[model samples]
Target: MKVTTTLIAAALACGASFAEAQAVQYAGGKTTFDGKCVVCHQAGGKGMDGLAPPLVEYPGKYAGTDEGRRHLGHTVLYGMFGPIKVKDKSYNFKMPSFASMSDAEIAEVLNYVVFDLNAQHGSAKPFDAEQIKALRASPVDGSAVHAQRESVVKSLGL
Candidate 1:
């Protein structure tokens, strides 16, 4: 009985730690988004007219599948410029590179975006730093935004 009780206590403690860590991460993400992405994506991820694409319901545009996630991460780390389509709407704007940010912070911001959008639109799978790192390592120049989008679409069989 004592052993079982000890095990339960340990589990509870670990769970609490995990929850605390997640809370911290979420807070960091919120801060990063406000500092960086909010200029265009807006505080609510709704974006600005004729300036940036809305991040709400963006999972439908960039997270419904594996290919979408890859594309979105690449776009985020390297930035995107020129013309692209989101939710069948064309957006010709510049997204500045956030390469200055640490991979963990990038991940946190992405998690916040994904979680917020998913909650709004009912999607699954939030992106993380590892995925962002891989995309960043690849050869994606923001200048060639359309090419990257085409590649992602091809990969998605879209």
Candidate 2:
């Protein structure tokens, strides 16, 4: 009976720690978004005209499938520049890289974005930490030549 009690206590402690960690991660993400993305994406993520694209709906260009999620994660970490099309409109804007952000923080911010935006846009799936990490590890050129915004939009049927 004593051994069983000890095991139960350990399990509870572990669960509590896990929950705490999750809470911290979420809070960190919220903070990061507020500091960075909120300015352009806006508090509601509606985005600023001529400056940022609305994140209300998953850009037909980047959401839903794994490939879409990977593209978005890479874009967020490395940034995108030059002319890009979203919702059938083209904008020549610069998106700076957040490469200095820690993996955990990037994951957290991404999770927050995916979950919150998906809810707003009625998406069934959301990007998670693991997905973000995998995308971050993949090779992406954060260069002007690699922007390929028009082609990507065309491929996505945007």
| Candidate 1, residue 72: lDDT | 68
lDDT of 1 by residue, 15-124 (tens): 99798657543677888988988988887688777779887765444576776776667677778888766656777888988887888888788777777544543454
C-alpha lDDT score of every prediction, in listed order: 0.73, 0.66
List, residue by residue over 40-143, the lDDT tens digit for candidate 2: 77875677777777666664335655556666777778887766555666566577888788777787777666665445424425456676677667657655
| Candidate whose TM-score is highest | 1
Summed backbone clashes in each candidate are 0, 0
User: Which parts of model 2 are misplaced by more than 4 Å?
Assistant: 1-27, 59-61, 120-126, 143-152
Clashing residue pairs in candidate 2 (N, C-alpha, C atoms within 3 angstroms): none
Candidate 1 matches the true fold with a TM-score of 0.70
- Per-model TM-score on C-alpha atoms: 0.70, 0.66
